[model samples]
Target chain A: MSLHDCRKAFSETLVALAEADPRIVAVANDSIGSSNLKEFKKRFPERMVNVGIAEQNMVGVGAGLANGGLIPFVCGASCFLTGRALEQVKVDCGYSRSNVKLCGMSSGVAYGELGPTHHSIEDLAWTRAIANLTVVVPADPAETSSALRAAAAYEGPVFLRLSRMPVPDIHPADYRFEFGRAPWLRRGSDVTLIANGTMVARALEAAALLEADGIKAAVVNMSSVRPLDREAILEAAVAGPILTVEEHTVVGGLGGAVAEVVVQSHPARMRLLGFPGEFAPTGSPEFLFEHFGLNPEGIRRAAAQLVEESARVAHETHPVR
Target chain B: MPPDSVPTDAAAESVSAAKMARRIRRSALQMVHAARLGHPGGDLSAADILAALYTAVLRIDPRNPRMPDRDRFILSKGHCSAALYSTLAEAGYFPREWLREYMKPLSLLNGHPDRNKVAGVEANTGPLGHGLPIGAGAAKAAKITGASWRTFVLTGDGELQEGSNWEAAMAAAQFGLDNLTVIVDRNRLQQGDETERTVGLEPLAERWRAFGWAAREVDGHDLEVLIRTLRAVPFEPGKPSCVIARTHKGRGVSFMEDRVEWHHRVPTAEELSQALKELGGGDE
Candidate 1:
């Protein structure tokens, strides 16, 4: 199996989509190389729009391109794309309901050494709040391709978060992607570890670690955050306690969205894990993940805690079972 | 330019424009008064021009608001939404009774336009400086498909101060969107201060011309002039048209004209009576 970065998967999948549909265009804020769009630029120069360092204009132009009968994949570093051009995304794309795909590359603490200014830990929270916008955080290279294809086919505005971290393939090559649907990777009656993007790899690793300690954990790759996987989430809650992990703020990102669904339906005990609502200090992405307790080991510890809590509650409620 | 010399057809369209202006003003006032909240000053300021576009100039169908071949009109300064909602309703996009729900919680006629909720609203534009670029894209789409549909966008003179508008302005010129027309309601007032004092657009006409648009100035309140100017669109081929319609911040209402305080401040009952009297035609 090829070890692929989500950025590479994003570019390759985009190139494939562009070949299949002539109306597909790539719009970047002078981050073609960063967004891994070199092959796309070479193959179809007219379809690649490099709008320099102007983030606001880049988003607006993407909306314009979409309105001009072309499906535009607007790509840029996550920080600038979401922060600088927030109003444009809200009005030009979300409000207009234009067929534009906003691809946020190198999200979360991926640019950790570049400081908090470069971090995009708040993107999910910000975009999920907007009505009529679809938000996706792909877990791995295969998921990246699936997400890209899904965004292309979806008829309205969508935000696709692609991580820079190198992750092993987690889904089959022929996996069919569906918008607003979560993929359940592992089925178990113990506890559920729900995650997306870079965190999914960590969550799968966490489930493996939990199994070594004689504990069973269900792993779910919750790629779609906006139109959350309600049925899957409810089932998971009913099966056991729930633990959500993501490379985002815990307030309004995937964790918050999942909690909203679970609380409404099942009302189960759950653990929310992510950036604990603060700007992280200067460090490498690995260091930040460890410091924030979001790596595999940390996830395993959190899942174990939830499992024990759920088992204790069940034992107290029904001693025979 | 002289008012009579302004090129307009003195036909049924012109008569409709006059009647439409009266209906729009009445509906806008009613909506604002019903909700007891709205930016009535600016709504009144842009009513006449919106009337001209809906009744006389723009090629749109109330029945098929989403028809790909129909002309598009985007209200860039979306805060003046009562005028837009009233104009759209009067033009038969939706029932006029819908105006009664304006600004009510969950009402389609929000403080700003929502394209999904309301018919005939080309784009959602509350946060200022967004409609032009979208309109430019619409025009470019028409060009791409070789369709004759045109795109019209209206922005407040104060709205041009937003940098996003300039970004769209540069792109519109770059694309040579000859089918796009941008109308500016130059009422010379912002919320708290005059537009000139806040951020001057004094050499505004020259600025747009430098940006490669065919620029013209006219009286915003003059229904006949507005009708003519909108029809004589794309004043120069291969360039987008910009009409700077000089207007009073609060036109028609006696107490509100040129008053910066009235930019969004609601009127009292006595004041509303005076305003209704000035707009003149009794209710049908």
Candidate 2:
């Protein structure tokens, strides 16, 4: 499979959408080169609003642009776009119901050397909590195009957390995206691995490893965090145990969403995996993933352990059905 | 601030003020009763000024809410939604009877002003400190388009504590948005307590002057003064305008006037009767 960064895919998809719809406008906070929006700005200068270094104004301006009958895709580094303008996003876009697309580039430690301040680990939790906002984390290039297309088609505010990390394309080029639904990658009876963003790739590797160890692991890519895929989660609960992983804090991220679903639906055995609610010490993105036990080998071990635990629980619940 | 000029008694001024104030109070009560659950106290507090604006000063069209040449009004402190809804209804943007479905699950009359949901609402603002920047942007839009559609925003006194407002203030002055007008509802009490105890803006007028705005102070309940001052917008050329309106928390309702507890408190049957009588809201 070809390798692609979701940020490049986002830029290309946005340009294509703009070509088709004149109402589509791109707004950046002095991040033309950083958000990969140089070509877009050059092509449509009138539609590009480059508000320099002012993230708060950038978000409010995006809302203003939307109010004026234009659909705005507000692009910037995830850390500043979600952190600096968080209140603006809540009030101007969410509360106001402005038709704005918040494109957060390089989320989840993608800026490897930029340290914790520049990393956007809390974006998922932050955007997910706001009412009337749809939070999306695209796993790879194909998912990125799908997410962008969905965001453009939807008539509401959306947050698209794009990654700068290069990843092998997991979904086929013809992947059709459905917002707020999980994409099932495999079918298994022992356990299910639900993930999004960069963690989906490692989840796939883990599933393969689990199969090698004579354990079948189901892999589900849960891209939308808000209107979660309750149906798929219920199916997984009925099938076997469920394990959730993400590139964010385990406390209130994807794992938390899965736990919420299981507690209400089938009440299956579950294991939540991610960064253990703490900032990672300085390291490369690859090093950090390994340190947090998010690599494929670690995920594989976690999946096996969950399967064994689920088997034990199933035996205790119904000795002989 | 025109050289600290004295108040003038222009012909037809007092009569116009009395008429506008009466209409605003009547409209505010009708909207709240229609919606069933809305912030009525703040609506009453800000009614006189909004009445002065729509009836006397602001240039707008009820039929064409999005006219390119029309002036813009942003209610920054949007929790007082009843006031805005009534103003727009009276302005003929929509049927006044539509206020019946306010706060209903499917109704567009949400708890806050949503520009997308409501006609004639320039910006959607429920949170404090969001209006000034948007109003600044609208003013900038006018400047860029070479249109003289002046932009006006009304904010709560307590809402100024948010740093975003100061940022917008600084930016507006920097851009010399002469088409921008900011009106502060200095109602003293916020959701909890008096703004002086919570966060004082005693030197408020000077603060605006320092920020390159032409500043003025007026009795918010005085419709005559509000109308007179609002009519003379952009008091100084090449500068934004800031009008500090001194108002009571609940201006017309005798028992509720200046009472901090009535911020969003639901009125009982007895209290509602007393308020209606105090407001002189009869069968019109």
Candidate 3:
């Protein structure tokens, strides 16, 4: 699988979008290189409003730019953008309904060795809680580009959760991203695997492994966490049990989002795979993913367990006595 | 070059602004009294600035609040919604009747200013330190597009404790956002204690200058002085302007003035009547 950094797609698409629309602008908190905005700044020096090393100000400035009739992509490390300036994200972007696109770069545990402080594992939880802000977690470069374009086209505030963690292409070359619509990547009936961001590719691989083990595991790339794909989730619940995998904490991330739907609509057995409460210990991104069972083998095992649980629940509910 | 922005006669404008400021004070007092909840102290403190801006400075029309090139005004010290709403109402952003529904169930006049709900509000700000960066962004946008529109933001001096203000201050100066002007209502009081005792922004003007703004101080209650200072913005050619408007917490009311207890305190009917009398209104 050829690895690709989605931040590249974020900047390239942003530059392309800015080239076409004069209203498109970029706001950064001194993360030009980190946010892959060097090309953006080089191309449109006048458009890049870099509030050096200030996340709250950066987010607020983005809202201000929106108020001034410019569509601002406020790019920063997801940790600072969501965690440090969560209130600004809540009030300025969310409550005000500003036409701002918050580009949370290097989301989840992408900052491997930098420890928990750098990890943006809670961004999904925080941003999704805010009203009127669209939360998007793209699985690959194609998806990232598509999502960015969609966010620009769509009015109001949006938070684009982009990962520095390299992942292979999940969608086809001509893939188009629709907001709040979850697409089924691999169809199955035994158990459904729901994932997003870096976990989607891994979840697909896990589905492959589950298929080898004769367990039919469906894979769904649940990217847009806010306007979540409820139809897809309810449909999946009917198919079988649900196993959710993410690069974030098990609580209030993709798993929690899925759980919120399942518990409300269709009751189903589930297994959520992610870091549970504890901060990521010292390790690289690969080691951390492997350690937390975010790998293909771990996801396969979780899916198999969920499949068994689903079968047991079914058997318990109805018997041929 | 907005219609009715430039003052042909400063004295006459000041007289009109002073009367409007009194009406704003009276309206705010009535709202607080009616709602039984509001930061009346801050409301009274900021009434004159809001009146001056709405009447003489901002190139905004009440008829067309969202005109593309209209000058932007943000009440960053948004807890003083009574004053802002009164000013907006008087300026005809909405009817004066909306002031009666201040903080009522599902009222458009939320405790904090919501730009989505209000016609003239530029930013939804109740949280401190949010307005400057936003104003800086608007100013930066004007500079970017070469638009002649200017952006003005009013902030409570005590709310400057939030570090986000400094961050935007640094950026505004760095970007040379000359179109932006920040008018700080230096009431010198917060919720608990005096701002000097709380966080101490004593060297305020110098601090703004250090952050790369052309800073000055004015008597916040003087309508003519506030109008003149605000109209003469961007004190330096290539820098953001900071006007430290010295003010008392409750400027119009006798009992509430400069008192910390009145920060978010509600006044009684008797006090409202007395305050309105002092403001030269009979509880209208």
RMSD of each: 3.9, 5.4, 1.3
Among these predictions, the greatest TM-score belongs to: 3
Off by over 4 Å in 3: B1-6, B281-284
TM-score of chain B of each: 0.94, 0.92, 0.97
Question: Is candidate 1 or 3 superior in lDDT?
Answer: 3
Distance (Å) between predicted and true CA of B68, model 1?
Answer: 0.6
**Candidate 3, after superposition: displacement of residue A145 in Å?**
0.4
Report the C-alpha lDDT of model 1 over B44-85, residue by residue, as the tens digit. Answer: 899889988876787777888877667888898999999999
Candidate maximizing lDDT = 3
Best by DockQ: 3
Listed in order, the DockQ scores are 0.40, 0.31, 0.89
Residue-level lDDT for B10 in candidate 2: 34
Candidate 2 lDDT, A1-321, residue by residue in tens: 556777788888889999999778887877999899988988877667666677887788677656655678999999999999999999888877878899998898888677899888888888888999998988989999998999999998999998888888899999988877899998888889999999999999999999999999899999988789899999999898888989888878888888988998799888888888888889999999888889999899898998888678768988986
TM-scores for chain A over all candidates = 0.96, 0.96, 0.98
The window of 10 residues in a row where model 2 chain B has the poorest summed lDDT is: B1-10
lDDT of 3 by residue, A165-215 (tens): 889998987999999899999899888999999999999999888888999
lDDT digits (tens) for residues B1-284 of candidate 3: 24654465666788888888899889888898889899999999998898888888889878999998899998999899999999989889899988899999999999999988999999999889999989999999998899999999999998899999999999999999989999999999999999999989989999999989999999998888888899899799999999999999999888999999999899899998888888785543
Weakest lDDT window of 10 consecutive positions for candidate 1 chain A = A60-69
Give interface RMSD, per candidate: 2.6, 2.7, 0.5
Per-residue lDDT value at B177 in model 3: 91
Q: State model 3's lDDT.
A: 0.91
Q: Across residues B180-248, which tens digit of lDDT does each residue of candidate 2 receive?
A: 999999888889898889888779999999988999999998877887788788899999999999998
